[model samples]
Target chain A: MEIKTRQFKAVARQELNNPNSRIFLDLLPVVLSSLRQLAMASFPDPEAAQRLGGIIRAEALSRLPELLEQFEKNALKAGAKVFWAGDAHAANAYILELARNNQVDFVTKGKSMVTEEMGINEVLEKNGIEVYETDLGEFIAQLLKRPPFHIVGPAANVPPPEIRDIFIEKGIMENPTVDPRELGYAARLYLRDRFSRMKMGITGINFAVAETGTIINVENEGNIRFNKSSPKIQVSVMTLEKVIPNLKDAMHMLRLVSRNCTGQHIGAYASMDTGPRKKDEMDGPDELHIIILDNGRTRLYQNVKTRQALQCIRCGGCLNICPVFGIIGGFPYGWVYSGPMGQLLTPLLLGLSGCHDHIWACTGCGACKANCPAGIDHPRVLHYLREMEVQGEKSLDAVPPPFTEDMAYKAFSVIASNPTLWKLTSKIIRTVLNRNAQDGKLSKGPGPLETWLAGRDFPQMGDKTFHERWKEIENNPPKAVLEN
Target chain B: MKTVSLFVPCIVDLFLPDIGEAMARLLKRLGLSLVYHDAQTCCGQPAFHGGRNPEAVKLAKRFIEIFENDETIVCPSGSCVVMVKKHYPELLADDPAWLKRAQAVAERIFELSEFIVDIMGIADVGASFSGKVAYHESCQLSRELGVVEQPKTLIRAVNGTELVPLNGAAVCCGFGGHFSVTYADISEALVKEKAVHYIASKADLLVISEPGCFLNINGYLSRNHPEHKAMHIAEFLAGKQN
Candidate 1:
């Protein structure tokens, strides 16, 4: 509201005061349990739920190596070549190498956060190649020269009229009032040209089934289908985490990840491309490469607490449901993933110094935790991050240890151990607070009391302590007081 | 007839003392004994929301220390009642004495609606209210604690009141604890949406169990839609009796 406003504190305090916050907080357990039920169940049956949950937990960490070997097997069978990229840089180079190997300068790209993560466009464009973003939102964002603000609805912060304005500025649409459909058609026309002529198509895999070496691309606009089917050389750069054991689970994953991310039952395009189209196949790429990029994930998965991040289907439910992410927007995560999943994932992958604040800003309300299909306990991870933060701060020698506690924690530990001491302390604290009440109301809440008042009104901390009243009633019982 | 211990949440005690009285009177009518633990400053709802988690435990420990006897601790506010029923055990785990107290208390800590519906085992409490009333589902009560059905069930069980659904009926009414004040703009947006739903629902009386929801809906009704009437669930029930 003001320039000097402590936005984070203000936002946090405001969230704390919200009635919905309480409702949501209380509602969380039920929501969590029910969603857990949803995630566990493939058929919404008891056995399927347990079975699916068990499979995920058992082999979630070892997904990468299994995926590479599976890809080798499946791709070799399908007469396709596979490349391995140790990191994002190598992955970008490998994709660029594919483009160069094809003698290609123009490429059509689909919406891929992983591509953004790898800085594919920058690397390719700097090497004097043309990249066309085929997804409508991605196209607008590319035109605006900005990374996507949202994963699913990439420009949530950009109003429709503003987007119309952007479209007109780019001359993609002649009128400023370009309805979303017309603007989409414009991109379709432009991308159709790119699709027909482009030598190579680049995309990201939502999931790669190890059983078939099948790469699944989930898209609303069918650009992923075009990317997979049209290009002479198709390279889908994927993080190793996308690999699953088989196709049945891959279909089940599509069923959940789509609904969870888009609030729709299914995306329009859920095409599974296994290597370039075979000679027997009716349509698709001649040269197919599934670049399995490790990119520091192997090390991240080495630890248990951080590894569930690998389970992120990139559903973006964590962003949409997040109260903070809803307001501040997602570009601030400063990377491919944002919101609850990104915070945990990016820190482990990119290093904490860059994305530690992602963990710090979380309210730990567990909306992300509850909604996560993978049953990733985001808040628990956030709690882990918080403790790690305190430890890291100590390690950094930022704030001297003496100042972190205000005689309060020390006093609490001591009193908690001795009941007599705690009782004495509560009695004294109540007395001092009650004394401040002028008209049965303590208008000015003191010290730590101020944080409480940031969004609430506190009456003088009860004039008569509960203990005193309880004692009095017990000694000389009034009928109602005694009955209570 | 079941004997229920009444936990009058701190907010009800101070701001809406009458609700506390109504809850007591309502329970008495049901042949239940009301035991007011006067020493109860709070269920540590404030401390928990403030993230003074240990202090919240401190407050809870003191509560268990003072009221270590056997009785069902039923609080009127879902906010505090949930804290007692659920979080209390997590807080007192290290101390067995306190843990036992927490476990015993949690088993009995019921929100007023829950106590009336489940323990009292009556959907309709022979209560009737006049006017078109749409109930706001407090997040904690509905989502966190899973009491969404109880209040609606009771409202339906009541004869006179027409139960109407608000738009995004399950959406937060911007009473995200401290959210109403801190992110006033967005909070105000959420409030306005709820108010618009109320207008569309054409409910003359808006009933909510939560004090925080009561305040936000009141503010929205005052500043924007001044014509709509709102009353807490306790106030509504009390008014019916009156």
Candidate 2:
């Protein structure tokens, strides 16, 4: 997928006007968030439950290298082949080689953001191995070649009419229909054929338990279950941070993930794979390959602060609660991740140069922080990213802000530090801004105010600022008698 | 008499000074002595939000120097208070003396409603309003400072004022300091949705605890639905009988 993080404003404006997306943007977030609130109420102490999730993730990330090694050792002991890939190319190469060695004509896949991040499907297709995304949303998104609109639902924002067109074009349905269930049924039939005949299946791990070397996946759809069971060969990939210390931590994370993602008490299926099928097993993969991909994550982990980006559980909780994401949908994020998750991670993974706009788009609202089960302080992270961008960091490829912006803040600091200067500057600004006033408001102004004035009338600067009016207010006697 | 020093935010100091005056009146009416520091400038929120940490640190030091001596410091803006209470310590972490001052000053500072209900233990300030009103929970005030019920407690105590529920009341109004200007399109969409929810609520007025939110929401309201109005919580609770 193309990186459009730089085109945030353009895509956001386009999405704001697109009625098809507007409908979903308005409904999905509100519904999901409210449902999330209700589901979280089931916890004896919701806040404590959320805090525990954060503690678990933080502890996991803190001991990430050791946990990964332990997980690899235990998985290897369980007869699973554990391959450590330092980057995306290595991971993709190994998977491709495995496919070629097995002489697999086609492969089925479960919904996996890591696979998408690696552009694994494109690589496999380019190498003449067909890849089928069996998750319904992923299937539609793959067919349309669009990034996931929402993390949980890849093509969720795509209107039914558009889906009907895509389904018809792809021969997923015999007749045209706009009903979602009917479309889903059509997709189910279409993908079921691939699931049965596919020799290999690929999936992303939600949690790789270090204690038991078991990989767990929580999903509403059963495609992942099929991805593990029906194929002769199963390849599950995870980033270095996915390994938790034990299954208990995984269970706690599972509760938070399900409740936060779709407001369910739990997902429809929780599948765990310790290794490939035993000789006595009736239905399971004969060969299980577990690939742990780093792909710059270790570089991120080297910095104590940036390591928080890996704490994200891919639950889409932050996306649901984010007000900015609530308005523009996910296209403007211009990456595999969107909302606060994308805003923070994209800058780290893609570098600050290309993802500058994503860092500054937040309202500094702590909604994402308050909602996150992983305990990531998104607003603080964004602030840190912004600081890095303005100051420039060689390691992150963060270039210092433009001369004009740098100078503007410098001037601001000077004026703000001195009260006399602030008071004087306020007077001059008041005089200049009031010139554009009509009916006590400025409908138009210069520079930064121009964008604001386009949609809302700015209040004319007060003639006598509070600083100028303080004496009179102080001298006046109290107006109301205390009613105690 | 307990003296409460005022830390008027730059926004209230410039475009919405009436909020500052209203805060003074309400505090004075509650029998507290108010002191306005002539040398107090800003909490350095814009600089901080702009990612200019050095600039923010300079202003944070200046803010600390001005207000650190006061026993109780109060502000009408939640974001400014958040800058002082939350970010200041972090910004000044490298400097031990300033970090200590920031932490000390942070404990004494409070948002208006927070000071009133939590500190002063006053819910009713002999104020009255006649019509239905809904509170727009400013993100900084409600989430950051955990000042959710303080403002509402004061509003609910207003004689004849019926506090109504607002949809997504705690969501951001999109005036993220520089965010409103840089990402104007997304900001407009969010503020528009906020206005839409306010109008749908059928309340006569919307009350906000932060001046930044007041500017953004009231700006949108004034332009599109000029008939409706949004007031700072200080102004609303300062005995403006509507």
Models 1 onward score TM values of 0.77, 0.98
Candidate 2 local Cα displacement, residue A404, angstroms = 1.5
Tens-place lDDT per residue, model 1, A143-213, is 87766666776654455676788877777768666477876787788688788887798899898777887
- Ten residues in a row with the worst lDDT in model 1 chain B? B233-242
Q: Please list the Cα RMSD from the true structure of every candidate, rounded to 1 decimal place.
A: 6.7, 1.8
List ranges where model 2 is wrong by over 4 Å.
A481-484
Residues A142-214 of candidate 2: C-alpha lDDT, one tens digit per residue: 9999899988988888889999999999888879999989999999999999987989999999999999999
* Cα error of candidate 1 at position A254, Å: 1.3
Model 1, chain B only, scores a TM-score of 0.91
True contacts kept of each: 0.01, 0.89
Candidate 1 docks at the CAPRI level of incorrect
CAPRI category for model 2: medium
Tens digits of per-residue lDDT, candidate 1, B132-183, equal 6788877667756778788888887666778877655655676655444444
